[model samples]
Target: MSEQDNATLIEVKGLYKLFGSEANKHMHLVHEGLSKDEILAKTGHTLGLKDINLKINRGEISVIMGLSGSGKSTLIRHFNRLIDPTEGNILVDGTDVMTLDQNQLEQFRRHKMSMVFQRFGLLPHRTVLDNAAYGLTVQGLSKKEANERAVEWLETVGLGGYEKQYPSQLSGGQQQRVGLARALATNAEILLMDEAFSALDPLIRSEMQDQLIELQEKLHKTIIFITHDLDEALHLGNRIAILKDGELVQDDKPEEILLNPATDYVEAFVRDVNRARALTVETVMQPQICRITADSISDALKQMRKTDDDYGYHVTDDGYQGIVSQETLEEAVRDDNGDDALCEKVYEDIPIVAPDAVLEDILPETINADYPVPVVDEEGEIQGELSREAIADVLSPDQVPEEAAKASQPTAT
Candidate 1:
């Protein structure tokens, strides 16, 4: 998981939920080490959740994922107190949700949290703009102000021209855009999305995932998304919480889960995942140990020779410039007499990968590039370098087929 500061946005502690007419009566059975099936068979009470302890940080997407009866949805409902916990507490920014009165809970849900449901929960009679502005309107904003804010968010979610159309008129994806626009229009700090994109077709689902990622980069809303799809969890989550039989089995970042699964259940979820797409350049990059300025041609060549490498990165006060090949430096030393000769020899057209760029994206560049690809940040600052060997190391399987491993090697050009 990402190293979050002590500042926690939502803290769920010892949370348990039982579904039955006399649920509270079965609390002792739960305390006595009764299994979910045993408790259900004896008391006719379903254990919706058991001792769910999680700390949701601010401005991060925390995904809850599991199979059909895994209680993933049940865990999220407690965030906004949609379902009351049979025992334990849910503290939102230090306020116990279980203690909130009806009025206070209503106010909290209106201003602090917004929900996007799987069924596109848009009212068929209300126009797109009205549905988007529903939260603002409920909060007593004037129609003019509410519509203005809704229009801006609708445009933000790519639904600008559909403001006057009804939900029945728009396609499934467009309707979900309206749903997102509705959630965004509220300006709620916490967003609870329950399989919000699951209803869409595969292509539209991918697009919505991309859109959510793009929006999160700009908005940074504290989102708690629920999904059974492991790919969706891996793609959208900054942290993922996996539930199994009403209990949390693991909670961790995507790469951590991929590299070190907590259990066989998690391993099964990740076993078929394309690791290259899940791992980023930051995960495998080496420190940029060999670097030289444009003025240091001889020094750069010496460093390259000592390291047994053919190239070194050209850097400046601003950040990274590009790669400098030993051949370029040797030619410059032999032909150019000027002090700035080394500067002219620096290859400024070298390939670059961003720190956040996935390994799958970097593979093509690494395979084709003559020199090691420099991993740069948004400001063009060189963070590290990635080699073809490093790529192969990360992609190597634990139990590789003999011929497959041999065939996977990149041929020299």
Candidate 2:
């Protein structure tokens, strides 16, 4: 109803849930009426989630993580109303999930959202194609149309030829593929995946993770994935929420969570993250810049030679824009002086990464480019510079000594 509410696809406010003890069942009794000692004495129950407040953005993958009994799974299950909250509101695109009647809940589950479970909940009696189309069939789709959609989704999940096979006929990985296809076939805007790959072997789990990423790239569906695996959480979650006893310990982008953890609990989860691999030059790019055109290669080269940052200099049509570099300057100078249409041969179409590009993406582009790549904006305008070495520090943070620490140390003390 409000602008803030519209920006949030899903919102939970002052949520509280406690198990056991009928005398203290209500949220108020649990959250406001009793202290922790009193609740333990009366209910002999634990708070599954305590005053949990969250907002999931549209078209983003938000991960919920914690150890067993931490409520990550419970919280995600609440999104589609699989488990009704004991208290507080679960709003889906502004509608209150708690208020949905059985029919409304069923319709919401069938048409508005779809979920993938860790167990790969496929019907053993059904063929892979039929399993994949189960959701569509449940919604009253024609068998022909449902099967057709199933086939298309099966191919997308790399199971095109396995359509006729039953769940028992497939491997664990293959069965999970069917589950993924089934969830996808509904064409829902929001997807809830609860440890969808946890049952697989490590190798298969990694492969499934890649598949999930590729699928997300194509579909851009908003997703909330629940996993206890820290690596998987980092790899998949655009933003992560670390839940401890149902309380939110941290909610932030992966890089921020790693670099600026809010609590010891969250820090332990991020302690081993390869921040370089998880980040991009785009994350650290500076905005202040000047632009020049290719026609003024001489002038651009001169400016680049004087600049100290990774941004060599920006290049544009009317005038040059972005960061420039010595390598770029020399390349431009040499090419400008050369005879054969050097301008066409020298410029590139590949996106120049920003300073924020993580070392993982940077190293490959650097090795390929043989120099720092130009950082560009969404409009394809050169903004600054991104270098292999700058990326290397992220990749090899241990090797790169802290300049601030060095500068601050007492001389020979």
Best by lDDT: 1
Regions more than 4 Å wrong, model 2: 1-4, 21-29, 32-42, 288-314, 318-358, 364-373, 377-380, 387-413
Query: What shift in Å separates residue 87 of candidate 1 from its native position after superposition?
Result: 1.8
Model 2 residue 213 lDDT score: 90
Judging by TM-score against the true structure, name the best candidate.
1
Q: Per-residue lDDT for 25-120 in model 1, tens only?
A: 889999888999999899999989999899998999999999999999988898898899999999888899989999999999999999999999
Error at 101, model 2, angstroms: 1.4
Window of ten residues with lowest summed lDDT in model 2: 338-347
* lDDT (C-alpha) at residue 72 in model 1: 92
Residue pairs of candidate 1 with colliding backbone atoms: none
Clashes of 1: 0
Which parts of model 1 have CA positions greater than 4 angstroms off?
1-6, 304-310, 325-341, 344-350, 396-413
In Å, residue 249's CA in model 2 sits off its true spot by 1.4
Per-residue lDDT over 1-413 for candidate 2, one digit per residue giving the tens place of the 0 to 100 score: 77766667888887776766553445555656565556667667666777789999888899999899788988888888766666789888889989888999999999989999899999999899999999999999999999999999999999989988999989999999999999999998899999999999999999999999999998999999999988888889998999886788898888788668899878777776776667666664445443434345566555545556433444545333333444655665686653322243444444466454555655555545533456765666665555444544444356333542243245784
